[model samples]
Target: MGSLVYREELEEDKNSAFTWEVQANNKAYNRQFKQKAFLCWWRKKYKRNAIHTAKYNVFSFLPLNLYEQFHRMSNLYFLLIIVLQGIPEISTLPWFTLFAPLVCLLTIRATRDLVDDIGRHRSDRAINNRPCQILVGKSFLWRKWKNLCVGDLVCLHKDSIVPADLVLLASTEPSSLCYVETADIDGETNLKFRQAPTITHHELTNIRKMASFQGKVVCEEPNSRMHHFVGCLEWEGKKYPLDSGNILLRGCRIRNTDTCYGMVIYAGFDTKIMKNCGKIHLKRTKLDHLMNRLVVLVSFPKSLLWLRFNPWPGIFLMLQMWPKKSY
Candidate 1:
């Protein structure tokens, strides 16, 4: 019985032969990397970088920012009109003269916003439509990046922004050494170097080898933390421990290598980039609120002046003190 137990322990050690562990005790349970585990983890945590789909449609007259402009400018214009309209001197003048400049500003702002929305739509369409290589049953096939699924093996090359978070498998560089530019995502200008597993370094030597590749990679659960990765690549009864050195995040540019191959670990919005972004809400500054209060405070003295002096002359005097909306 003791001999049998020792044999089982030795076999377990043989299968779990890994070089480094990123986390001391948080390593995945001792199980072979499986397709089901990859799919289950991806479906549970993955998200795509997507703008608000409900907003900026061609049918809508107002772009996303138009409402914000209205809140900033139109609201102030109406408040001023309400206070000044009751003045007898201003009421005698053309009412359109009071609002014409404000109307023009609003029109110009809306036009600029619409153009920006159109540009955004064009960019989104282009990215979603761009093609990448995927292994399709012993041959490589071109597939759109947007439709990429977890566990899909992708072929990457120089100067292209990676579309999804991936595990390094093989690269064209000797010893599977690759470098990438992460300036687009984390604002790092330096080219960061990455490595494929030393064990699987020679597996993809040519197009035929890459096209015929198949493997399962098990990694840490998807997380919002940038610059942290814990996982492993496994194939043919071997497990290779992986860290940030063996990972390529989405939005990073491949550089200093002709081509590389990776397995998509997380796709869509569940990626690190999308997960780390804060909520889509604006935070007004202290100065903004102070300026709004200043307008109302200044309005009080103007109204008092009209009450103190004759209403007609005081009305015109008060108009000169009016401050325009900041936005």
Candidate 2:
């Protein structure tokens, strides 16, 4: 049994193989868009370009919402009361009375959460479906943001939104410089310029050259470092150093450059902005916590009343039935 378990563990380890290094347009590791995942066991699996921020969906709404709502002390207390009311000996009221109110309260809260999450879903859809020009072969063609993959070459025009984190390759501006506005990313309206390496700027000057370009980038894993980037671009048997100034981040807006080309380094949630967005968690305000405490406090007296009144008749009968003792 131990040997079998070890063999299974080794198999699992082999299936989870992934790396931080990304190779541009290399079919050996960079799986093409629209390809299935099951066929790519030996290759590294990268994150998709689609992002989901919604907390619940059609299949998960009821169960997930109930699970989240019951995390509150008040809801659990109410549920306890409803369960107690189901017992004829302990209950002073019908179970349905408390059950109905709980159902209503849960419905109201769930509806509110559902509406908010629906808005998030719509926003995600809009962003993911936004159009951009991607290099299909030797020519660029329009595609949705979600269609982008790591190692894909992309073209950005002036006033365009960047779909993913990309390395600046070449641009129409002198010296392959590209300007961008990071208003959506940092809330700063200041324009920042990124430049391509001297080798790429001179060599990959046209669409045909960019299509045939194959460069491997060795870099650190995705992180929330917005102003820092460190990597090296390897191409044509030479390596060029890269930094933050050579990279264009997702959520940046192209500005003051007519045409610029880039190769995607990070897509989807791996992008720095999305990494900084972080995961959504259940947050309760002070007032919410106070309300929960208040519910418990308010219900305590009712429980005390039940304890005081319940079985009192039996106690009186027992008192009357006690045997008289000679004093």
Model 2 lDDT tens row, 1-327: 999999996665444323356787765576533325576545345786999999888898899899999988888998998887886655799999899989999999998999999899999999999999999977899999999989899999999999999999999999999999999998999999999999999999888888888888877678787997777888878888989999999999999999999999899998999999998899789988998888878888877887688878657656765788989
For residue 83, model 1's alpha carbon misses the true position, in angstroms, by: 9.7
lDDT on C-alpha atoms for all candidate structures: 0.69, 0.87
- Model 1 TM: 0.62
Work out the TM-score per prediction. 0.62, 0.82
Candidate 2 vs. true structure, TM-score: 0.82
What are the per-residue Cα lDDT tens digits for candidate 1 across 1-327?
A: 999999996665455344221211111421122333454563323333343322367666555555676555335756478457656556765556766776677789778767876776787778777788877766668988777766667788899788788877789888898899999888989999999988667766666765555556666556686787666766678877778888889889999999888877777665788678645454467776776677767766787776888776666667765766887
| Candidate 1 stretches greater than 4 Å from native | 1-45, 48-55, 59-66, 77-100, 186-189, 202-221, 234-239, 274-290, 300-327
Which one is best on lDDT?
A: 2
lDDT of 2 at 240: 89
Best by TM-score: 2
